[model samples]
Target: MSFDSANLERAAAWLAQIARQRLTARAGQLVETDLGAFDYYEDGSWLAHLLRRHQPSGEEFGILMLALSPHICPHLLDTVIAEVRPEGGELPELGGVRAAGHRAMLPTGETAQFFFSGMNMSRRFDIEGMFLADHWFARDRILWLESVREGEPLMSGRLIVNPEIIEELVTGKIGRPAFSMDFPAEHIETAMDWDDLVLNPLTRAQIREIEHWVKHNDTLMDDWGMRKRVKPGYRALFYGPPGTGKTLTAMLLGKHTGKDVFRVDLSRVVSKYIGETEKNLSRLFDKAENKNWILFFDEADALFSKRTDVRDAHDKYANQEVAYLLQRIEGYNGLVILASNQRANIDDAFVRRLQAIIPFPMPQQEERYEIWRRTFPEQIALAGDVDWRQIAARHELTGANILNVTHFCAIEALAKQTREVDLRCLEEAIKREYVKEGRVM
Candidate 1:
């Protein structure tokens, strides 16, 4: 028979065993069957097949069986069988007449509760539940369950695994749960490298330090127990003028480390409602924890601004939001880079907590020339008269502005139907950029 058929048959057999045990217990008679023998693999049973497929080491089969416990429970198995075979028929025979029912009959009140809590008592199968519970507390898994709001005593909550896990089981490929549901940030595709970044010696060294920290993070945090002594994360502040390479540096760090970069959109994070900002940030951090992700907070001054005096309710709540963020950042066991144009605007409390504060200074004349030289592709034809040194000296522009002028000049050359970019085109591009910025050029 097919895998599905075999799996369902095995599930039915397990449920039948549960029914027999329950009936025997209700009758107050001494059960004679060797329940321990049932744990062994039958010749053509699903456990035997799984053992062949996985070839796990000692006790792994027991763990896998425990993980499958909830699925093989009488209620869920009956529900699945009923849905599959609507035109009901007797369950496949295992041994006793008690196991011949078309559907598992629901036990009344206390007995019904016993099915979920006591079904595994004989096997002492509590390890899987304990493992999952520990992971939930460690923030490795999110638990969603129904609970009473306020002081009311509602029905007891049951652990509901997320849909991603359910999908993995159905596909027979169990893996880590993907946080697609209620994830608040967007993943950024970083396409930068060392060659694309232009900064001073100190800034470059600082960037290299950040990369090194990420590379040996596990050793420093786990092996050395630094997570317990110090903060469990690396928080760096990239501060400089607009158009300096702060954002690019953050992206390059993520690319070099092979980690996904998520630029947190402050617009979405800073909610108008009370306590909403904390909720949003908590969700983002919970989803990102242990996921090998780099959290990039660009234009961070808005979110990390200095806390104002409590003149009103807005001011008080705003400080509370900042406090919440401070706690979350400290607790995160990953990389977080916050970029801001003005470093002075950031709160002193945050600055004190940061591991590194690297300032991205505007490019000097020599650096600007390097940026211009490297900006164009080798395939692009440039006029012999295009003087990089003169242009770098004439315009007090950031690296970003220089790139804009280069692009504009190339497009201008293309419009003029020329294969070569000339000095005049470069000058015109620079002039246009200055005009856009309202500079006296």
Candidate 2:
């Protein structure tokens, strides 16, 4: 409820600037001036909350979302930046990041027509300035970003601010702000089936289907007159044997798209408390909706397993979890992957929404042989008499299994002061891997 002398000074200075701007300005009004157009939203909310011991209201909230919108309409950012001219205080800058990169500044009066646009906007590249502004005077502040992009002929303007990108933008030097979360930059969508990753024609075809939906450009599928997304985008179900590349495929896709992939920890996501599962799923979906990340749920048969008759309370709750999961999967705007070894275990209701379904079955003999051969480094010293066919005939390992066995074999060969993996050592690893699976070695 009380602020230090410095805090009082900031709040005073900020409030003074808010009074200077007309917060009710409509979208048609061109923002060409000072902090007067921007109301102090976020900082004000925190102040009011601290004072009243409750949540802030109006322009006090949604500051982060407003600052991040990609195409802000009617020059809202332009107005905000004009107002933010070198206030007495400046924010801290991490190494190599400019002042603008850290936060954005804008005027308070720039809402109205851009209300919805600003509410969800986020993540525009270089930040320009940052200032706290309020929308409607319900006692709160909103953080605003000030930046611009090159515009096309539709408006005959050089500046373009996107309102669509509202979610990932953060203001101020605060650590771990929701808008500052880093989306992972790797995934399986980048797999070049024929050129980079070795795969059979069928696998390549399936990859093409996924790629088509992913908006792969080289194929020109969009301009080629296809009216719809090949598979569209729904949470997909990938099932088969492990090491058959289910995880690899997911990672490849994420990597290709320059998005992060997050594998949900079902243990943390599913809870015994009522509505806990829905809450957890909602949080993940909300995060993924705005952030650049692919949600992957591996070994998901436990979470997404078929629902049985609700005779018991446990069964009823389990069914509720399934229903919640289905809704989340359908609502997610980006790609989601659920992988399980037991395809039969997934409920039929859940299965119907998959945009693309691909099996990662255990490799056939030919594929297995190719996997084994590729598993080793090209320059490894070979006895020249290595029989891949014989090895393939003898080993029942999947690509992942083969990769493990070969990696171990290579290390063992090195330990033995030999450049090439010997049949004896290779057999030892293969036997160990097979025994783990309860197969006769």
Model 2: lDDT equals: 0.55
Best by TM-score: 1
Pairs of colliding residues, candidate 1: none
Whole-model Cα lDDT per candidate?
0.66, 0.55
Q: Give candidate 1's error at residue 131 in angstroms.
A: 11
Please list the residue runs of candidate 2 whose C-alpha ends up more than 4 Å from where it truly belongs after superposition. 1-200, 216-232
Candidate 2 residue lDDT tens string, 85-171? 335333211001123542434322233213312222231110111231232221222222233345621111111122222221222
Ten-residue region with minimum lDDT total, candidate 2: 123-132
TM-score of 1: 0.74
Candidate that scores best on lDDT:
1
